[model samples]
Target: MNENPHPTRQLEEAPVHDQFDVTLEDADLLGEVELTTNLIIAASESDEHLEAEEIDRILGVVPSPREDG
Candidate 1:
């Protein structure tokens, strides 16, 4: 004698770990990821193309020597 067409299912709660370790390298990588994501967003919004120097600056990359002179 069930009137409801669907029945609710119960979900088990997952245990939470209060203690977590963060390394300096992990933080640096996270910062780099954030910066890259922001750059991608800005690039997608802009109509103009990004210059090589600008790209290098945003990625913190050193510009290599161009042989095509």
Candidate 2:
């Protein structure tokens, strides 16, 4: 018993992007932030060793807090 009567309806139309406006650069930045956050969380939870490049990438995405303000 399928709850959605038109299961394939979503596939027939184009994707709707009315929720928010995000440029390509913004989208890429968001993706990097998301990946870095996930990696940081995973590293904190497990004892796995992160490669030098991975560590650099994660550090690059995280913003440093202001000291003066």
Candidate 3:
């Protein structure tokens, strides 16, 4: 029960830019999902809730806090 009239139709006539645009969009979405999943795992394994400073450290945005700071 496919809704699209051209469900099996080929994209042979489609423009190259259109084809590659979709590919790039898909890759970007996949990367975003992967990063989010990894962050969630890191947070869950951490002893305490992830703070802004800790998150920055994980992302290498800032240096790790000093023990005496």
Candidate 4:
């Protein structure tokens, strides 16, 4: 029932990386599945979904971008 008789016939490894990694995250993860490679925003539940507008409203100040803009 094995498609490939030999394991050494892997044409590629790790697969191709998509140019972008855009994702829509929800605060309430009630019935959601936890991916092993998900970009977890915060360690605590109280401080989640770090959107720019949300961040500014919370901290009462504009937050610096983590990555170079």
TM-score of 4: 0.21
What is the total number of backbone clashes in candidate 3?
Answer: 0
Error of 2 at 68 (Å): 57
Q: What lDDT tens digits, residue by residue, belong to model 1 across residues 1-69?
A: 767777787889898765665444687789988888978986998799988777777777886778986
lDDT per residue for candidate 4 within 3-69, as digits (tens), equals: 7666686566777778696464764452233421222433244455556565445434666769966
Segments of candidate 1 deviating more than 4 angstroms:
1-25, 62-69
Q: Tens-digit lDDT track for model 2 on 6-59?
A: 576445776888756755568778887787788878689767788766676666
How well does candidate 2 score on lDDT at residue 41? 87
Best model number under lDDT: 1
Candidate 2: which pairs clash?
Answer: none
Alpha-carbon deviation at 51 in model 2, angstroms? 8.0
Q: Estimate candidate 3's alpha-carbon lDDT, on a 0 to 1 scale.
A: 0.74
Residue pairs in clash, model 1: none
**Candidate with better TM-score, 1 vs 4:** 1
Over all chains combined, what TM-score does candidate 3 have?
A: 0.42
Name model 4 segments beyond 4 Å from true: 1-43, 46-48, 62-69
**Window of ten residues with lowest summed lDDT in model 2:** 55-64
- Flag the better candidate by lDDT, 3 or 4: 3
lDDT of each: 0.80, 0.72, 0.74, 0.50
Where does candidate 3 stray beyond 4 Å? 1-25, 59-69
User: After TM-score superposition, what is the CA distance of residue 41 in candidate 3 from its true location, in Å?
Assistant: 0.7
